[model samples]
Target: MNRFPLGVWLFALALAAVTALPYVAGALNAPSATLYSGAALVPSGAAVDYNSHLAKMWQGRRGEWDYQLLFTHEAHPGLPLVQGFYTLLGALSPFDLALTYHLARFVLTIGMVLALWVFASHFFETPSARWICLLLSTISAGWSWLLLFVPGATAQVGPIEFWLIDAYNLIGALFMPHFAAAVILQIAAFLTFEAWVRSAGAAWRGLLLLTALLAAMGIVQPYIILLSLPLLLILLGYYVISAKLLTWRRALWLLLPLAAHTALIVYQYVAINNDAVWRSFSEQNITASPDLLYYILGYLPFIIPILIGARTFVVDEADDRWWLPLLWVLLVAMLLYAPFPTQRRYLLGVQTPLAVLAAYGWTRAFLPRISAGRRPLLTGVYVTLTALAPALLIFANINAFAHPQMPATTAVYYSADELIGYEWLRGQANPDDLVLTTFGWDGQGSGGRMVAALGQRVFMGHWIETTRFEEKIAQIASFYNPVVPDEWRLMFLQNNGARYVWYDDSARVLGGWNPADAPFLEQVFSSGSVTIYRVRLNG
Candidate 1:
């Protein structure tokens, strides 16, 4: 009994270490990337659309333009919501608004920790089990890093704050918009599972919450929410089978979340073609095929121990019959089947279960095997290591990943660089002048909110996602695929918005890959990676 309380304290220390250590390192390593030093910093890149839309939401409530920019600008919805809410909380100031955003993010991280505790406490009657659950929650690969470095996690940096990997959406939700969405989803799951397990009767509340959450997630980051649904179902199934005292009333609670989720799906179908977007999934994220083995290893580095523990940890003959086996089967299936040829981000579906498995593994290895005589020494060793792992694994990787000195990749630099240029353009461009760049993700018009931020019009860019973009996405694929046309070059510039073309070094690399004989555009100005071109639109 004494050990349980001690273990809880150890877990609390571990949680603090996991969450706080990385941010300290990031702050110490600050100025890693180039700070946008020029003129007005406008929303650019993929985030432009999300920023513009969210800003539009605040229109009329405040000045349509100023409030939109103030509330929704600066790369994420998370900040806006935080700022917006704080503004509402009092007569708002920028500092208060900023504090509210970070404070909310910190609180959400705590909520996640609390959820892990509840989840662990319920499942594991053994003190060891509780310890493992708490440990796993702090250390799980995606969950831990995601909570720490992501803007929603720290309420700073780029906007890609959603559950997905997109820079824009993540930034959009950092203000706790998506965090709120995710928490609502998990809470619904928690309540439904609670009712399901204890047979506590139907939870109409979980169902209602689930509907609102799914709807919000759909409107914000639809694909991520869609991907998460199957895994959530599997988890729900695990909950339904696990609770020892489940009643028919508890069984009815399952229907509530499901009904709510189903209604949202129906609403999405009527409002937008989900199947259409899903069908494009295979084509859009064509990276190296995800290996089942690699994903499993990523999630569970100590699979053998976990499996051994599951096999060894026997329930009493009177215990819940369906619980252990169902959890195991669901975990195994998710591990084996969750990975596909698509992006690794889709693997997020399996993370929650993997966290559970990791928790189980930690408990089995570290908790029950304690010998009374050596318990103090063993506990000291375990506590020391648990505290160190976050510093070692989480902080080290975040430092490497978020380092500004690292050369930007085609995918990574698009938004940041566009912000740089948009700041410059804000001073240079007149209201009558139009900023021209490549269609989609040419890294020029890709940041439309930046253009809008400058009060200048973008001739055309990726954010518009025009009818011509279907082929543009295909052309983007041509960098890796064989089917794309050479005409993509001129077509991209002329088709959408191009009064003056801006070409970065990346365009040159892509141009070399093109098979076409079209004449290159004339370069008027050259500055490092940023280039200006006046392309004859007709040619």
Candidate 2:
């Protein structure tokens, strides 16, 4: 009759209740069948991404061309993995695809939280570890952000993005073929846990397992996986120099794993550089300044435990062997590579490990000091504060998520306006007729590029990328930016597949330019938020 097991089970059950609270609220409180603006859901731009993929999937599933998802559909290899997972779950039903993806996101979030908690509990003293686990499981920025908001305009500012991040990370963990490939990462995480919990002999096995896990994770998402190395090295270096249990023989075994990991990473880097498929992957400017506030918000709850507990932890002299501050600075520098607007999601991989460190710090510093006499008071205070933390996160996310709203001209897939526009277009166009889209009025209201609006099998529209995509955008921008003559607009239309033109009065122009020539373009449809024109072919 061990009450300890009962206590642990109750604690875990309580954690589950806390985790599902938002879902329960969202289900009951939000409008029927309406998702909250920022709930952790599927991938952001999900409707758009799903629509695009479905078209491609449909072609393939229908036995048209064997599922050719090249440049037109999902451009990256990672997306294919997501699509494949969803496709299997959906089993060819569009409704199922949407429903399943959403459900999968929730499941993924739960799994991530569980994994983090298990990692904490396995590595630390019970009560201290339980606090760390509770804090992380209940109130991380990712946790709040995922539950409180609904999916909307930008992929970066949506709830489903949390699941997407988890999906990407987990996929990298489960798949990948290399030694420290994605699949191996879970093993590595387990091994790392073992190192802290077990004896020296057990720790060596953990290192060997860790090396292999890192190889697998590397295969799944090499960029993030590779970035993880310096931290691992720092930890390994600490164990080597400081641990009382470390003998030359044991150290040799540990170093062997490290050497193998390093060699494999180097090989992967070279192989990726040589491959045409991944050649452009690293070439893109995926850099941005790290948002310290975002990191704080994202990781603060779990991290606070580490901060409070920092002074009591036994710090190995080896901890300072490698300048950890310098390594951290380097990793921070790596954030600068994130592109233009500076996305926070790209930094999730780095943040995950850091949160764990913060948790460890908390346990070592604060948990042991609070005597049993004061425990209830401390627990009550922590719970009260923790309760407010989720609310604050939801508020912050809602405030941050709404700022970069889409313009009226941009068709956001699954948006009300976009759905209306699609209904209008379907009514106006014949089965065989073409409807050419102008810039911004593309694919199913999902803010797709203009080329996406060409609903017909044979049509082209303005798309922004490089060469043609860039050149075409430049051409349209020239007319749209500067006040242009009617004929110039007409000529521009001819250059693209200008079967029809659509404009939204509410859309903000990139430059201060007016379209006085709107009347001359043969106005075919006009509404408050949208305007359509059919260019006279001969004229």
Best by lDDT: 2
Model 1 agreement with the true structure over 237-334: per-residue lDDT tens digits: 54445533444445455565556555655554443333342223224434332334333433443354456466544542434423432453364454
lDDT of each: 0.42, 0.42
TM-scores, in order shown?
A: 0.57, 0.54
Model 2 residue 320 CA deviation in Å? 15
> Where is model 1 poorest over a 10-residue stretch in terms of lDDT?
70-79
Tens-digit lDDT string for candidate 2 (1-539): 25244554555455434444433443444432223322322223332443443334333333343222222211223223222332343354444333333444444444444444554454455665555544543343333343345454234433322423321233111111111122224424534633633364646566656676555454344444434666655555655676543555555665555566666667656754564434443343233433344444444554566567555444633343223323543564465354433343234344344445555554455645778688567756664564464454334333433432433212222334444565566677542343443333232222232222323221323121111333444554565665666677667666643555555532335444544355546776655556666767876
Question: Model 1 scores what on Cα lDDT?
Answer: 0.42
Error (Å) of candidate 1 at residue 154 is: 31
Model 1 stretches with alpha carbons more than 4 Å out: 1-105, 125-129, 140-184, 196-256, 266-282, 286-289, 299-302, 314-370, 373-421, 424-492, 503-539
